[model samples]
Target: MVEQNFTKVKEFILLGFTADLQLQRVLFLIFLIIYVFCLLGNITMIFLICADSRLHTPMYFFIGNLSFLYLWYSSLFAPKILMICITDDKSISFAGCLAQFFFAAGLDLSECYLLAAMAYDCYVAITNALLYSQAMPLRLCASLVAASYFGGFLNSTIMISKTFTLSFCDNNVIDDFFCDLPLLVKLACDVKENYQAVVCFIMASNVFTPTILILASYLFIIAAILNICSIQGHLKVFSTCGSHLTAVTLYYGSILFIYSRSSSSYALEWDKVVSVFYTVVTSVLNPLLYSLRNKDVKDALKKMLDRAKVS
Candidate 1:
């Protein structure tokens, strides 16, 4: 079989948030702050989870994984974005772009499964409190974590492989910050109908499949919560799941709006703004959502602070 030969794109110019000097500086400052906060928040979540024995349950285990994913997701793109803003060097090599896409896609897909797994954990804890530990044993929790990473790697591998197969004859300018699929596909001179179909199929499978699973898990979870007779029990169950529900809604809402729609109709500026929400804002929010909302994390942080002060 003749392997499709691609004209190696020496570099890709990433048209970041804006080209206006003042606006670019302002946006850079904003994203810099966001990047710092995202790093601190995720690190805090990880430290709290590790330091506190009280949060050794499956819920915290999944939260720890979520924090790790957000860290990777942000690290994959944010640094490049910051550098682009400061140095105004938008040139990224073909190999570099593909590498960025691989990591970003892997982390994004892993997060989707991680969110679903967290929902499932909630379902087990709320629906089967008596057997929560038995249901979500340590080994099963480890397996879930492994499955998220495996699914992510598999999805990223397929997309990256398919993407590199196409020839980039023209249109090297990517109108976004990073090497995203839609923009890369648009750049390919050999863009085929089958390639489009494959992309659509991948997006559907990666985006919708886990969404359905998470929704279904929550359905059963709500049912279980309603079945609880005591008002306190109902409140407790709702409280337990509220933070996760908020995070899911924010993360998936932006993704669905961007990916589930026709690319032709996609408003680039609006889509970029929404992308910021998911990529930057969501990363910052996850740690706050899990830590601030959960008493266990707060207590853990307090203990760590105390230990620091004592030392």
Candidate 2:
């Protein structure tokens, strides 16, 4: 196969979710509502965590950072999705596509490691309750969060560099709303077998490393809970982890489902549906997951409202 050098290509045409004008209008409205809710919800979560001195612990610190991550994460896709749906101009510059892919990769990658860090924090709290404060000191917590961001962006930088270097043909139409690796790979004129292997290795490391850490952390957590004599004590201890567990399942489940299949087996329609779960739905639900399921957050919210009424 003669490789077409499309290095001169200036832009990509994104084939968004639907072509029908009515459906596009409806999608526009739906995404607009969801985006607004995501912003407000994450902002509220971050505010509550920062405002309440009670939420200064390691768990809340991670939750606050997760909220911050979602703010940027959701923002990265929502505007582009909105523009693609609401207008006929579906073109994105090559540089813009790369930028979108970079940030989205960085943020989600950060989230995976951050979630692992949160799982470990939970483990320490349950296994070493007496020493949790000592184990998860503020400086250590900050360092973990810093490492997550740094590692995420570094991985993203490598991913984009390898991906964008592939020569794309003049057919620059991306089949999805976003600039995902799979979609970009499909557009490349000549993707080496080794390159695919390398990409797979990087992605697996990014996902599985944290997944293994989480499962290990939870295994120990469950063991600790089993050793407790009273049933009430077991439930009490497990309740604290309920929110983080839910967040992890929702985030990781959607991600694994989308990426687990070979690219040849992908159903773009289903992929779009699953993509919405991680990109939009998970973000919107994260704040509710933490605030609604948490007693401390509820109490903090109550006190804040009471203070508002007084003022």
Estimated TM-score per prediction?
0.95, 0.95
- Regions of candidate 1 where Cα sits further than 4 Å from its true position: 1-3
Q: Quote model 2's TM-score.
A: 0.95
lDDT of 1 at 12: 91
Encode model 2's per-residue lDDT on 1-311: one tens digit a residue: 97444576789998889999999999999999999999999998898889999999998999999999999999999999999998899999999999999999899889999999999999999899888889899999999999999989999999888888798767888878888888788878889997788878888899889999999999999999889999888887877788899999999889889888788866478988899779987889999999988899999999988999999
Count clashing pairs, candidate 2: 0
Residue range 110-175, candidate 1, lDDT tens digits: 888888899889989998888888999999999999998999889889988888888888678988
- CA lDDT of every candidate: 0.86, 0.89
Q: In model 2, what is the error at residue 246, expressed in angstroms?
A: 1.1
Q: Candidate 2 vs. truth: CA RMSD?
A: 2.2
lDDT of prediction 2: 0.89
- For model 1, give the RMSD to the true fold: 1.5
Q: Which candidate is the best by lDDT?
A: 2
